[model samples]
Target chain A: MNDISTWDVVRNLLDGVLWTLGLSLTAFVLGGLTGLALLFARIASTAWLRKLAKAYIEVFQGTPLLMQLFIIFFGSSLIGLELSPWLAAALGLTLFTSAYLGEIWRGCVESVPKGQWEASASLALSHFEQMRYVILPQALKIAIAPTVGFSVQVVKGTAVTSIIGFVELTKTGSMLANATYQPFLVFGLVALGYFALCYPLSVFSRRLERSAHGTRAH
Target chain B: MTYAFDFASLLEYRDILLAGTLRTLALTAIGTFFGLALGVLGAASRAWQLAPWNRVFAVYVELIRNTPFLVQLFFIFFGLPSLGVSINEWQASILAMVINLGAYSTEIIRAGIEATPRGQIEAAESLAMTRRQIFLRVVLAPALRKVWPAICSQVVIVMLGSSVCSQIAAEELTFAANFIQSRNFRAFETYFVVTGMYFLLALAIRQLMLRAGDRLIGGRRT
Candidate 1:
């Protein structure tokens, strides 16, 4: 818990970045898949299913991620299930991202002009086929930019997992800082790691936005 | 595994939970009020492209937007004291919340400002309106009306994000719940009640914001 070499701290910090990356990527992919389903359900369904999906979005989006993580991690274990910290954090982030991403994609889907739907309907395709072949393809192309943009949110969100004791980058940074008595050096590098992971996605999202502008404006 | 349900314990902590909700609501209201003012100025600066200040505002917006609210909270609560301007946890948390919300609001409102039709500005000028008159009458008012929904949602986000202040021991709802659980060891019941409270409060605030925003721009709806 005393003074430690910069190298030791850096290595430990690197492990933190790995956990952050692991948590963010796991959440992003799983969240994306789940969100796509949610978006489809929201758009292509009866009134009840749409309301259910809306409720899901509102519940997840309305609540704080930290509280959600706490509920998943500790609350479940309180009942009968013994959930791991990583599992709980991942589940929380996945649910959070799904709500946001579902809404984003739903907007994009609905943003596809009604003319497109009418045009597709004239071709005698079912609603699902219209989405699969025509609407979704265009919507997904538009969705790529915002989806990549939200990955920044996903990356930043992994920092919250530290609160749940998942020992991700932020948690590790705090521990190493506490052990080394170097909060500034430790957190500065921690911020650097997050910035490094997220800045690229930010740049990518902007590029997607530019490309989107070049083609179709959303 | 079957466990008996206990609602009485949760009900007993209603006063504590109520206090936390009030604190959180106060934080959200004060934060949104000042944050909206800061946001308006920031958006105006960007719209005006006020030299170096605009560049500085841009960096502030992007930096805050790209990072985690938790890190920002830590930086303020823990990172600021090293520079010798010590603020308490509550003040620091509120400062950070306002700063973060200000940046996001600037972006949203700037988009609104930019969307104002160019011909209206020409019309205002033809009527001999000065720059100030034109901005208030022709620019800021209508722009905010149109952008109210986006701003409203981001404000709700600020409300939700304020829960992160609990980490710094801000005595907000979540912080209060954490205290109750640690003391009472009723983690599940405590959080269940707390979560329900948060959901209800958030829904209430969101509705209020929507109604307020709609009224502010109710004329525009027609």
Candidate 2:
């Protein structure tokens, strides 16, 4: 067997990084939209809708992301839909992301003072209008930091998709480790690749959090 | 959809599932115990600014927090052998879970520690308390109480994340699901049942942690 050079491993892992980034971005955007809808259902006037949303969030949050991917990937095939690993990974991560994001944003929404809700109601605004025009606007500001913070989780989460056979960084690292017989170097680079992706978001999230608190202090 | 669900097939493998469940629980218990202990030590070191150790822990926390747990598991299980530090899959899983939870709980506990009032520490100092005495007797309990809910949530998250331990063939609950499905060719039913099992486990752990927190820290608050 020909020996794989270190440069070749690094170059190949960089290719995996793009797929990881693509998957992360796809999950985040799709998840954010779905999470927004779930957030609305969660805080809606109807008790049943709120409970339904709560149950959805609880199930997704309670179960492992790997299991979710397995169910979607394998379950879909059993039910006659042959989903590609890409589709399965995206769908699973999207659902997982939505549940957590919905819950996070829900906390932010509830943190908006009760007075804002009452004032909007006193103005004869409909529930939807109150949320769309007043409550969500305020919640959006507070939600920014946590939402950005969660994006870091989304990036880290993409690594799990590799288990479903998506050739992302982690999967690529494993393959290269096997070929090169250099597990330490391959996996170390894999961890560093993720750190490069996630650390900036973490720092940015902290900065946003601090500035948020700074404004609140005044 | 032409497929008929067959959860009954999984029942025949009940022993496998049971063993797997116990293994998963055992891993989580061990991980949580040592992880939280490590968190306490790291948090104290960082919170008190204990020189070199503080910097060491800061880098450790950042490294663990930023990377995915799967990669860490891979490094410990697959990577370490090359460095002449071999560990079995079970040991590697436990180690990964402990380290992952340790980094997170450090940050979580540190937040709690940092929130301790300046006057409280000063009062403890005036009472002629040593540094360790002040940290343990006066500062630790309330800080833990404040952060107990967050800690509980992180514990549950780590528990759920433990499902990935199956990747390295740790023979946990998810591993049982994989084995059952591969045998019966009932992937959907197997995974579905196991997911339900995980949901129940998560709920049970959350409730248990809540009660544990109340007993450990709640009474002291009054």
B128-172: candidate 2 lDDT, tens digit per residue = 999889888788888888888889899989999999999999999
Candidate 1, pairs of clashing residues: none
What is candidate 1's lDDT per residue for B36-127, written digit by digit as tens?
89888899899889988789888888787877888877877776776676889889878988998998999999988998999999999999
Q: List the residue pairs that clash in candidate 2.
A: none
Q: Cα deviation of B107 in candidate 1 (Å)?
A: 0.7
lDDT of 2 by residue, A113-141 (tens): 99999999999999999999999999999
Q: Which structure among the candidates has the greatest TM-score? A: 2
- Model 1 chain B: worst 10 consecutive residues (lDDT sum): B213-222
Q: Is the docking of candidate 2 incorrect, acceptable, medium or high quality?
A: high
- Report lDDT (CA) for all predictions: 0.86, 0.94
